[model samples]
Target: MVLDKFNSVRMLNTDALQADFVIVGGGISGVCAAITAARQGLKVVLIQDRPVLGGNGSSEIRLWMLGATSHMGNNNRWAREGGVIDEIMVENTFRNPEGNPIIFDSVMLDKVVSEPNITLLLNTCVYEVKKSAGHKIESVRGFCSQNSTMYEVTAPLFCDASGDGVVGFLAGAPYRMGAESREEFGEKFAPAEDYGELLGHSLYFYTKDTGQPVKYVAPSYAMDVTKTVPRFRSFNAKEHGCKLWWVEYGGDLDTVHDTEQIKWELWKVIYGAWDYIKNSGKYPEAETMTLEWVGCIPGKRESRRFEGDYMLIQQDVIEQRHHEDAVSYGGWSIDLHPAAGVFGEESACNQWHSKGVYQIPYRCLYSRGIENLFFAGRIISVSHVAFGSTRVMATSAHSAQAVAVAAAMCLEENISPREVYSLGKVSELQKRLSRMGQYIPDMKIRDEENLVKKATLAASSEYHFKGFPADGEMQALDESVAQMIPLHKGDRLGKVKVGLFVSEETLLEVELRVSSKPFNHTPDVTLETKTVSLCQGKQQLELTFEAVMPEEQYVFLVFKKNPLVQLQYTKERITGVLSVFNTINEAVSNFGKQTPKEDIGIEEFEFWCPKRRPGGHNIAVQSEKDCYVFSVSNIDNGIDRPVQSPNAWVAELNDPAPALTVRWDSAVRIGKMSLFFDTDYDQPMETVQMTHPENQMPFCVEKYKIYDGEGRLVYEKTDNHQSINEFVFPEKLVTDEIKIVLEHPSDLIPAALFAVKCYE
Candidate 1:
């Protein structure tokens, strides 16, 4: 190697590259955008300032990824975001069930690099942007510190996913920081100046046990918890990482420019908290415990929100307003943090839940003025109050997916981003996204080319409305419990029988409840309430409600709280069915019910949530007559999850070999096939800090085989653990008939499929 010695100043090595799409910041949103665009055959360049991807979810700053399935603590059932983010989540759960941040980093890297169309540049920061005529971005300049190289990447379309809107700012995109006035958007939930304007930044640390006495020396900059932190007494040696989410600062200051200052304050607070645990003598249990790992970088929550054609406001979320250009959905509550952050006297956050998930319009994804620019992550177009709900990682990633697909379409048509909406192409975009497993509320996949749509479908056996067998443990009715059973329109739920064990003779109260809205899962409207006397023994009680369902939806057979009574649970796991208990899960701030002040502009509703796996058994209940709809035609309903109805065809529990056959009058050619399976969308697969009991979902299909018209095996798969299984044939498959044979996930669980699509 020859070393260069020059009298003149030498510049860094410069490289020029061109791509169809250029995305700055390798966060979850950017990663998802790159993967999606790459999958659509676009040459993409993904740039990251950090060494690894997953911005907030990276090992350097480990924050759990969450979205619509808000910790599974709210009434939004089966509300997980889909598409590339869904694949990443399912893959993370399968490979890193333990939720190691390092492993998660690898998972992100693996996904991005696995796509040949994507070129990832880690440890690279974009500092310059070049714009062309007509307000379009032509290129961006970035530098990699490790390689000491300057890269000028030119692309037709550009996306800004950086946490602070770096590219958007440099490109002169109009944006707003902090809160908007209540009168501006008529948002009553908007924060007052005294309360807070902008949400703050948070830093987290992890601790572990050393199995011996360990000591720690606080740095000179370490803060004094007793003096500086008002909530210092709340600190416990057991709490670590994101559990200390309240350990935040930098909201009152310039979050973007003063990030370093904020990070220093966070570090001081963390060290001081640890010092109190080790030196304060308040915890004898901490003697053997020591600091295991600390986050190097802080997880930033909010900064500058850029402008788009439409700015999502408070009412859009609370009212569950539908958007014709809807591309994604969000269910997280309107969460806001105080500007004073960890040092504030106010509550750490104020969250208000809506009745159901709301649609995110495509107009809010791309910049309003910048013709070629797109917005992703926390920087998307929304009012400050609405940002509280749309700022989560999963929601951001899901929205960014819309950008990826739009960018691909733009490149193909040689048009601007706004033209995709103005030209009436939103429906086609929605259909494409749904086919790729992106869930859009009230939107159905209308792919006319799907071969299954024109074929006759039949299943070997269908699951009738029978009660779950009493095979699991008994659960005490300390809190209200409800079994979510699906009922069709005009169907009458006559009499129901439930197995219960009573300690003493007591009065039992039962109620039949449903949501005021059809798509909502909240059991707010009570149809009928009945009171019955119980004896002190294990017996089946008959509950006669005789309530007629006006519309097709999931009704709750609610059992009121009774300490003396215990309900029987069954081990069977079925798609679109679950048991919810009215209780407190402080993690997501669900305290059994939300009783907000009437003037706060927030509605009051009870929160009935399901438990995690290895538990959350179904309640054993039998109906006098079958009312559930589980037909073979459901497999072609264009819906992949349970919405107003159970959109799945489930085989009977006793069927030894479950099979579904499709027949066509004439032979059809299929070049690709996609299968949708049950993966329990209710389970919020948090990427970090949460450990799951099993590597794969118990309801996911593990084995299946597909046969053609000639009774010859076309394809077979085993060890399947994902919700969407896709196969592309090198040679087209021509057949007049197709058969699918499946093995039950377990003896107690039935075989279920949401939808099937065969495309040419």
Candidate 2:
């Protein structure tokens, strides 16, 4: 088109988009938030600054995702995070077992892009937040440099999944940066002196074997080859992304504003560190290895945190306090790193584990000042000390899912997030979240839509001779392993059943110990040790302990090593058990190690309490109210986690051709039904999980068949790979009774299943 030749100049195009929810950030939290909200039937716009999904876990940063289930993998039996992140882990495990960072990135993008209700905008950074009246956020503006467009997105609600909490920042929301003083939040883990310092950013590098000797040249801008930075002993050719987690910086300065400078320093650090490893002759094994990739963008650990309705603190975590509105559980230790970062001298940070799983309330997820604003990820309302545990990505993702569901409830009810909390609608929110596969510690499901809730059990599943299924295959626990056994006021303990192996004549000292701090989940206080000698071979031995019991105290059973004697260990990684090392020669220590060298939660080694002849327990198909025996029967307990003992159901191991039937009260129109099968709750589904038994996961219905009333065959499935199996019928089936004929997956072990529900 011919226009007047008026001074032509480049124009800035501003595009406006409207959605029900505007989520800023593409981190796991943001991804989960968007997915959860979108799945709940809300139009969502997810703006992420990076080209790819996964904030820290992306190929750019490559920080491994560790969450409420601490990486150490001890006493975290069922602490694996579920929700949206669980789906990612399962898919990633199946698709990218080698743990390729790029594949993981693709996995995240596929999930985000596949959601029909989600408009995922990658490489778009949301910088400005527009707030309307009454503490409400009207919209946010993001600049996408790739398309050279500025998007002004308006929504009824906003979520700051941005790790930096930028949306909340611009919305004038009350937020806290850096560490609060000890007196500010009464946090015991807070620094003795007040400081506006936060955890630092980290840089990492990957190396690959070239198969031939490769020479390296150091960049001129690289730091000193060996002088400025330390850690000579830890730096090895084998160590890569996660092993070098301590390569951090930029905590002393402003992490957000001074990002470029930090990035520069990190780049130089990686080069110089690699130079030292290759040229300085420190690592001899580097001769054939070459640097494959180096990260330019630093992974941030701490930044601006929004002030929400409640500030989670140290007392809540250590005391294992139960919240009425507890929406998520955090089992990770209080891991607070110093600001000195890579230049620091001592170990990374001060880590303190919780005695048991702690609760994260819904109150801390929404803005206190910004009425329509909600937050997830590391930016949730928590003191720096409390943030130590909640900052992990998995925990943050759980928080994201919680807020997203809450946001849906808000949108449906036409109320603010604050109203959801003030009106005591948290219970309803918790019920909804649990129904969606979120684990709320003390919550129970009461959904009227759960058709299984009304069904009466008319089945064949043998009762008695039932107990918690054993995680197949156990090895000798040569290391120090202990469990945080709960003791009542009158409980007595004298002996424990242990699988012991001896290579030569040796003795092992067994003892019971308690955590040094009454609240800490560590076994540093030794009560006593009993020594027993053994000969060469494996034996089921009964280790005796003095009848020394304390009132309502958390204690650990300590086993000392004799080199020749090794106790049998199962990789189950059971909850309530802890592994203690380095305590043998230390005067004072924080348990053995918070997450010393493991990526999974602490290992559940084999050490059993001596019992009289295994009287065992029973699992009967009772009323639907009490479905899974040995498990608390309720709507709240879904397969998100295996409820420790008997997942509340009988395995038809000893029965002949078992068939469990659900007789409904009346004809219920059902087109889709969901069956939650047990997938070895004792093991973990998280990427951090280590076990991979050859057989199918415990209680997984490898093969099953379904039938309607009148014994009409309706459905049959074989070799199912997923835990949550869903069946959608082309035409809705109006039936009063539905039956499942269980074909035991194993002849020795019962084919155990969890929950069965129908959706209309």
Best by TM-score: 1
TM-score result, candidate 1: 0.99
True-structure lDDT of candidate 2: 0.69
Report the number of the highest-lDDT candidate. Answer: 1
Clashing pairs in 1: none
RMSD of 1: 1.1
Q: TM-score for all predictions?
A: 0.99, 0.83
By summed lDDT, the worst window of 10 consecutive residues in model 1 runs over 1-10
Residue-pair clashes per candidate, as listed? 0, 17
Candidate 2 deviates by what RMSD?
6.7
